[model samples]
Target: MLRELEKAEQKWGGANKAIDQWLNNRRNLLVHYCRIAGLPPYENGNSLPSVDNVRSFCEMLVDYVSEGHFEVYNQVVSACEKHGQTSKAVAQQLLPKINDTTDAALDFNDKYTEAADDKVLMQLDSDLSRLGDAMETRFQLEDQLLEVLHTRHS
Candidate 1:
């Protein structure tokens, strides 16, 4: 898992700098998420995540999603439009899938908005698992958008 994440962090760069920066934010968010979920290095013995870790992840998660939806998506669409009609058509076709993932991400964020104590974190195990699945889907969709709309056009 860690290896895959590291690979993704490095793979989606050099084409569009703005998209690279946005992908870096995604990488950082995943690192924080791995820590909170006690994956690999974070899983040694009783190295459960502290409340601070969870809180930080939640904060970063919101910021990342917001930027993706409001800034990065718009930039991608604009770039695709500038590229040509075919690029714009491809972006339009993929947008609804991307929007669905955004809605899922927002719902996940809402579940953790009031996460104030350890109990809440404990209860979040299932939600986090579901979030992992959602994030995987979102990442794949976003990568497709980057490839079709940004990298190819660039």
Candidate 2:
């Protein structure tokens, strides 16, 4: 469990770094574009990025989603197995949620180019909101499983 936790932590850290880099690049791109175009960099509570911006965001987003599916979740499943928890059943429970997240991510990727429009941006917001809620549920499920493992082992 500890090893798996360590691996997951490392993957999460990598994702964090990637997000940071993407954000910095994105900021620079927007600033440069605005300067060249003689327009102020867009601000005013806009949530979604432009098509190019969303494309860049989706690159890192894909990375995170891939890690979540193959690395982090796999580690969690392995932890459950090593500790004799409901590895199989828990994985079954998690599969659809993971699939939902992955599918949503793919949808975002596909629509990212079209997301500059207000309607598309609104859809992106809705998709992202769902993704956020799904991730929270995953976190809670992992916490619950960890508590059970700790209680049994400790």
Candidate 3:
């Protein structure tokens, strides 16, 4: 997973540094999540994920979402327009799914914002699972947009 993200950064980083950085942040967030969920190396241990790790993940999650919505999406739209492509149609088609993903992400953030206790963190397993699915959907949508708006033009 980490290597795949690194390759994506190498491929697309120069085109948009902000998106590259956000991808790197997402990689880190996934690592932290894996540790918390005991997926691999941490699976041998019985310890819960540290609050600091969860906190960092939550913060990065919000930043990634914000950058995607406010910066990266705008850049793609602008690029499509500059290239004489009909960005409006594409944006309109994608808006609903994007908005749904945003809502899910924000809800995840809100749920974890005050999770300082172990009980709260434990309860987050289900929400986090749902978040992982939402993020996958969001990434696929964003990648599709990039393919049309950035890759083709480039």
lDDT for each candidate structure: 0.76, 0.52, 0.74
Sliding window of 10 residues with minimal summed lDDT for model 2: 29-38
Note the residue pairs that clash in candidate 3: none
Better of 1 and 3 by TM-score: 1
What's the residue-level lDDT of 76 in candidate 2?
A: 52
Candidate 2 C-alpha lDDT tens digits along 1-154: 2233344444333433533343344334334333322334444354445556656666765665675566655655665677665655666576676566566667766776455565666565566556446544544454444344344433
Worst 10 residues of 3 by lDDT: 1-10
Number of the top TM-score candidate: 1
Which candidate ranks first by lDDT, i.e. highest? Answer: 1
Which residue segments of model 1 deviate by more than 4 Å?
Answer: 1-11, 44-48
Backbone atom clashes (below 3 Å) for every candidate:
0, 0, 0
Query: Model 1 residue 83 lDDT?
Result: 84
What's the lDDT for residue 2 in model 2?
Answer: 29
Order the candidates by TM-score, highest first — what do you get? Answer: 1, 3, 2
> What is the per-residue lDDT of model 3 for residues 1-154, given as tens digits with 9 covering 90 to 100?
5565666667677787777777777777778767766777668365777777777778888988888888878887777777764665676577578779988888878877777677877766788788878877887776667667665678
RMSD of each: 2.3, 9.1, 2.3
> Candidate 1 at 94: error in angstroms?
2.0
Give the better candidate number (1 or 2) by TM-score. Answer: 1
